[model samples]
Target: MKRHNAGELPLSAPAGDAKRGLGKEEAAEQGKVDRYGKGRVRWSRLCFLFAVVSTACVVARHCYDAGLGRGNSAAVVRIDAVPGPPRKIIPIARGEPSEEPRHRDPPSPPGDDATSSSSGSDEPDDIDDGAGAASSSKQLPSPSKAAAHGHQQAGHPFARALAAADNKADLCGGQYIYVQELPARFNKDIVQYCDKLSPWTDMCRYTANGGFGPLLRGGKAAFQGAGAGWYDTHEHALDVVFHERIKRYECLTEDASLAAAVFVPVYAGLDVARHLWGNNVSARDELALDLANVLAQRPEWRAMGGRDHFFVAGRTTWDFRRKPGAHAGWGSTLLNLPAVNNMTALVVEASPWHLNDIAIPYSTAFHPASDEDLFFWQDRVRALHRRYLFSFAGLPRPGDAKSIEGRLVDQCKASPACSVMECSTTGPDNKCESPAAVMKLFQSSTFCLLPRGSTDTLRAAFDALLAGCIPVFFHPASAYVQYTWHLPKNHVDYSVYIPEEDVRKNASVEETLRKISPEMVTTMRDNVVGLIPSVTYGDATSRIETTVKDAFDIAVAAVIDKVTKLRRGIVEGRAEEEKLEKYSWKYPLLAQGQKAEDHHEWDPLFN
Candidate 1:
């Protein structure tokens, strides 16, 4: 082999041969380089594919663990298969708990600490669960929707949670109330024609100042302390008064879901009062029927079927429980309605036989503005020097010749120790109409006689308590059965009960009362003074500054407690088994067996 440059052909060869030899050698070297380069490129591509697949697997695993892959296995695979650049994954913050499904009771909105302002539109928006998962397209179900859906929305988790939270922090101890926004015809329209509400007197004045009537004047000197709380309140103004008081209720919630009880402000008493004197049964019943139908259609009413629903009747239960086919009956058949039978009625006088009827005190002249004022009045009454041993203040009931009112009045007039303020049937001489004169007489007496009025109960008993006068009852129905919630359980603690029969048989009222020792009388008077707050309605114009429960407070609490128990009983399926009618007249006081009719042959009286 001759020595030569790298690309040079050997000597003594043909030019074509050398050229061809160089070409072949160069081609062979290029082939080796191309093969090696192609192999390296393929290996690099294989490594990149492996890395991408491994990264996708890790991401899919994470998505599955995070609950995003639930019910979608294809989604996990699709994450890697999508024709897009790789996405950057951000890790969750350290120490943060993983997102999980949780169920909690919902809470109501914050209550109005002061006066309740309008809650805006009647229909509220559906509350969210705070998870940001609710679709914007969803809306609160309408009443019709709720009806068709069987009140499914009432059981919504979000609403339940809100209610639970509000209940926990409620000043009313889980007793939240919801007032329905009814048509004006149901309440306000009737109130507008206050003068026409009563067939006799002009009720417009009494309806003023939130149904507390006019501010009482000329008698402030008689009241203790500043005497700023007294009002010339009418006896039948409880419906308006209660409505006004509830409007300022501290625990009022706009959301119905959170309500422990629902209030249907129908002004049932006023409605019935308008048609009471007339014989038009249709006129009396039409509005009540309409109210029943309206309430029955509500979602709130559907929740408990009116069992947890209540309203102020402002009159005796008899005023609303007119017998069917008695076209000339005394009042509208409101209480007898199928819809009303299930609901609770707070009245001035409750029926002894009806479980749904609850007795609340009639509106008295004294409405204490604050706890201090109440205490002052209590002390003032306690310190008074009573002049008369006993007193009577009322007109004789007409047409009831069997009534013992005549004998009692005669006995009172004959006794030098008794002060009698006789009321004329029709004239300015009707001392019973004057709150000032009546309270004065009651205040001056050691004991006040409480005989049966149009019904078995009388507002005078409460007036006597307000005046720190021990009540002398001729019948148990006058106070014991009617005011079980307001009065002490033992009748002897605050009142004297002499059988009506004994009084009719010429028993001496003065001699019987004089027999009670002075010390015992003092003790009873002290008890009567102590019960003033519970029997007296507070001024609705402002909130009570102290914790002392007034008549309004006591009634509302009892109603709330009752409704709560009723709802619980319904939920536990025991409400149907508890027969309220089977119990006795003293059901609330004695539980059973003791009867109002058993004493003084009172069976025919209720019938």
Candidate 2:
């Protein structure tokens, strides 16, 4: 398959053009005959009346058969069957196409050098997932601008109140979200080739059960029958999980005008996963560029330059913000794209300095199907007897001088109070790979050491919290600065922050943890347990029975609040100047006279 730069690709022709062309030709021939005489004009009039009656009769019959004639206003319309104008294709960072052989073939099947997928899911089609096959031979319908901006007319006051109650919009602070209907390539197609997403492992399993992974047995005893919600969730499945969760968002509105925020459900992390190991920069950035070009043509995107739009990048922000001109860089430049910069990104790990990136928790094994399951597990963890003082459930970083993993591992091994589950570099039997074992390890320990890995944050931190273990962070970037949205503002409220400097200077891990009073530890443990609900992602298939908000709920609410503030700032005309103050959680942490852009030593870890 040939690759074309974003806007260089030629747009597909509209469907049913041949039939329309035939009709125009017939009209032209009739016009010529009508110019002959008055007698011919009368005959034409009679024929036009007959044709109109026949068309009406045919439409009535079709409507009756489809149950639409009985006032079925909710009749599903096949977008392709409806006649409309040709879709407008906007190129990314380019003017009109120059006709330099811009057309390319449809994406090949999975395992080939194909850029995307051509098919969709086997379930019922919905606007949220953008489910449908898109090929060069078929032109998928573009969302109508009018429909996107249209509002539902209010009916009787009492009826309107009843409808509002049914929608439960009040629960979301009157906020509504519109999920953008994107082409299959942007999402579903990427999921179709899930096995090819990662170079190291088959990611197909992670895409199962709405990205929650496989179900685990024995939930009745643990979760009080809410155990059905528990799954062996993969850390990187957030892209698919977030997509599935938002599909069932209670505040979702089909009319964009009523929406407080717009969600673009592109599995961006999965799009770049397959390209991270390869040196081809174009291949790494292709999907991002294509996604940008597609959004550029959207009317919703044109409003406020996508400030109200948000997406989930399941991986760390570093994976998407590749340094320009660095050919051997680690990941793609998805977040760096101009079109993407304006939108909010919900990532597993965020850039402390970037205003658009917001850190969300990684998916842990525990996904509560209901509040009962969530509360039961929280209570179980709180009551469990933590035998070890501290524990480390990670591998050692050998070469990196900045990594504190080596010191932490050595200290944990030397101390009897520390339970070290040393993960091996190569082995299928690695204890860290098992969700049950990892949770048990953390649950048995009072403190879980979260050393900075390849990235500032680790999935283990969230898992530790899930098991009701207090996280011990060596760097502010690991949890303090990254997850301000989910974690407490004061780090001391729920975690222990040991400066990496102190650890390198040979500070005893056991001694530092032992210094804390038993009362203080209990308080911190209680705080950590209370955070289980906010940090945990609930089952996407079901809603929590109570008012407790899970990670998905928190992220959505945060996005709405951020967008609301941003839109207000724009209207006040101080958005550009107040951007850092508005979006940067790190702004208040900057030293006196220090700018938000000032370089920091830990910046390399995120890049």
Candidate 3:
């Protein structure tokens, strides 16, 4: 087992503090502003959903009192730090004339990389100026400008809502699609609410509300790709799209729409989501399952502790099926994909055969509606998240060339915890070189090493695991995040690993390779063999259980909340006609993932 001590860093650091560490006044404002938790957490600001909800409230109040959202009338609530009336549109958001990320905390959203064609913001992506204290103080383009720029193209649906929010009647989901269980139509598009919705924006994400102050500093940070917030499967990907339908990003889609999008979650999250993180890519879809769980309180808003927002009318076969019911669809259908697909088989194929051999990590998904959560997760977590990045480190830097392929074999032979092939002496044909060739060569090897920068997520990491080979990870911080994850815990694992100093010190990997044993390697391999089949090519029913069901719950809930509070009407429900058979929580989606037996993971499903 590769127990990582540095794997969860980025998750805990970078922009994490900005959201979690709000002071008492900030906390109270957060509480009353959006207050999203299940009434339990008074402190944890519903960062993602909370912001939108708050904005919704503001938008609603403004429209009712200020005549902003009078239906079809457009109103732009420019978000900035010190709240104020809306700002005049600058025809073009030619942001404060091109600058670089400044010297503050890494709270600013990543900028469109040099490769992108940005319309105006001048801030660069490098938030810390590559220095120390500076990381604690830099800023970026005005939050208002960033938000406005982040969302352009009025032809888009969100834009339409922006246009009509001040005049036309608010749009609902029933207008979009029909759900069997629930009647009425509604959507989560901010455009639909326009004048009434204000962006309760924050600093970390690429959002722009303009209140960062000294926190907002200098340059334009480079976009590394989307952060892959919290999705675990393609089902999760669909949910993101469902919520942000009109926002130009899948984050706009509701949970129900997510139910319809069916694809492999792992690839969907890591591969597809990364593409959209900075520029036009749908960052929400890229969120990793782990991150998703953390944000599940309202998946609709990845940042706001919610599930992916899938706002569609109706419910799922929840009324029909019982225990081990289908996973909720978080609005995945909006995207161009199937809403559900069998992931159990994929889980099995992805997991290790036995439970006792290794440790499986599970996500407890915050028990919504708790007060301890307010102080602990909401408050303490905010503090810790800012101080210590306990999740996977953001990404890896170019390391000294030691040939990863060579390193893997070498490390395996030397380490006792792992089983490795001694390819040092392999003949020209035996020494697989390229990532593809190397992966093909070790398809069945007990473990394979996934180094840094494979020009996108690469094929080996997923392939090696699918082939029943455990991935000997090296960069959990960089490669693994909320945007992508599909492996079962006991079956497959990774962690906060390789302390930065260790990597920087350039300690010869040979020293670290001293760990591991043949027995451990055998154990890990056994688990891998067990998880593969369970995760991929699962039966249609299995897909519904894990992917479709989960997404549906996410989308439905978002719609329900929006309607009950905003529109005050009956919400959509899932249909009973929907068949729910063989509903055997055959595979656990939480911690331990596809790993069925060993429930000793750090996350839930294990406890």
lDDT of 2 at 562: 74
In model 3, which range of ten residues has the least summed lDDT?
222-231
Local error of candidate 2 at residue 276 (angstroms):
0.7
lDDT of 3 by residue, 135-162 (tens): 1122223545324532342211122222
Clashes of 1: 9
TM-score of each: 0.74, 0.69, 0.26
lDDT of 2 by residue, 404-488 (tens): 8988889889988999998886558788887777877888899999998888888899889988899999888888787777888
Candidate 2: residue 309 lDDT (0-100): 86
Off by over 4 Å in 1: 1-173, 224-226, 324-326, 570-577, 580-584, 591-607
Q: Pick the candidate with the highest TM-score.
A: 1
Q: Per model, how many backbone clashes are there? A: 9, 0, 233
Angstrom error at residue 462, model 3: 0.9
Order of the predicted models by TM-score, top scorer first: 1, 2, 3
